[model samples]
Target: MIKITGEHHFAIDRTLFVFALDSEAGKVFNEKNKLVTGIGKVNAAMELTQEIQRNRPELIVNLGSAGSRSFGKGEVVCCTKFIQRDMDVRGLGFEKYETPLSGIPPVLEYGLLKEGLPQGICGTGDSFEMNHAETDYNIVDMEAYPLALIAMKKNIPFLCLKYISDDAGSEAAEDWAVQVHLASEAFNKILF
Candidate 1:
């Protein structure tokens, strides 16, 4: 397990695994070729961008814990579509979640789907969603959108596996804290 904090780049395997935090990686992922990109979209985008520049990976696999009302806790699901949930440019005549002047679509349909696993639409934003009333996305995450967008632009295959840790409800913070540790194990079972 590698924590990507500084600008230094490390040698990684063909399939690069990415995690939002070290704790989310857990003990089982210690031997795997992984990068801990910290939290939030900017961190994820910067770290992933650097890694790709240093050594282009054959495929990028993002594994992290997410909040969802539609999925049960401890269940690992694939995310094929990503949304920048915080990008609201409605006042500028652009639609909500649409990046102004950027050609990228509001809903990014990029990510390799895993067979037998159910798929989800991830809404990536800076804030931890709690009691959010949005009905568009089934999953709420902090970093998956940028990772998916970057991979899509680079034409590299991307696979997002999110372990449902919370329900994006009033008790999301508490639930996530307790359930995040189990996400790594669930992902290990699915991918490793």
Candidate 2:
């Protein structure tokens, strides 16, 4: 067993695993792993940064459930790109997802390729998505953008795998609750 001594006291190795908001999404890994959960973008960024600083993990893998209109429920997809859908600065002449003062681009891209996982673009916001026609992204989540951004800034390898739990429709929450367990199981299989 790997011994981890830090502020978090995690037993995980050099790789830090992360989840978001819901507990069901992390059910499998939470038993033996010290996984971080960010309820939203701000919380995610802060929590992930603190974990990275404390543990100095070489890589960070964020696994969670997501809503998608294109992907079928229970399908897991690796997010190659992340965008903040709630960061709207159109009045200041910046694009919808662009952060004005930040040097980072509106869309942060992860080039890592994982075998057997389909590639997708994840658009993240604070609110749960109920309409699929509002955005063009392949998946919708609440925390992936900040997690990806923090990982990029800290120069750590970041990989995001999201399980489709809903269709971003009126029944998304209900669907998500039912599919989260399956997502967690799928994530565990991929990681271990």
Candidate 3:
């Protein structure tokens, strides 16, 4: 029993999962409940708010691709924090990522997931690039951040399951898509 809407609408079954995006892709994972929109983070929050204003779920699981600085091929990571790495305020001699608002709970320090979980920093940016490397970062993406911010704002449980699609190197651009697919499969194993 898989329920899907847009990339966001999901239902709980034996294994609840969601693969949301600003655009439509693949076969209808679940057609009756799917939603399609280009509106992001803020708009997604509003949509989710209105939806939940009607019915709230227990948890939200986000699955997506991300660039990696330290993670190896086909690695899965549970984010402790989401960073907006592109928010550069260097022009003003300051540094910040312009986080939306915080309300989400902190990651469980020691839980069932900690036995062999990969620990790393997940950062967000509009573009996927290897040249823009940060020594402290391990992963990069465009969506998880706003999801984290919105989840924080709504005080909801959020888990980001990401697959490492690229390395912080020149070849990453051409290799990302294939790597993303490989990583997604690996992520499912770790998560399930």
Name the best candidate (by TM-score). 1
lDDT of 2: 0.78
The candidate 1 region of ten consecutive residues with least summed lDDT is 1-10
Best by lDDT: 1
lDDT of 1 by residue, 29-83 (tens): 7876678999999999999999999888877889999999999988888999999
lDDT value, residue 21 of candidate 1? 97
In model 3, the runs with Cα more than 4 Å from the true position are 1-11, 14-16, 20-54, 90-94, 98-115
Query: Model 2 clash pairs?
Result: none
Candidate 2 residues lying further than 4 Å off, grouped into runs, are 1-12, 25-27
Better of 1 and 3 by lDDT: 1
lDDT by residue for model 3 (39-117), tens: 3344444555565455554555556666676777667776757666766555664445542333222221111122366
lDDT of 1 at 3: 19
TM-scores of all candidate predictions against the true structure: 0.92, 0.88, 0.67
What overall lDDT goes with each candidate model? 0.88, 0.78, 0.54
Backbone clash pairs for candidate 3 read 5-33, 5-34, 5-35, 6-34, 6-35, 7-20, 103-152, 104-152
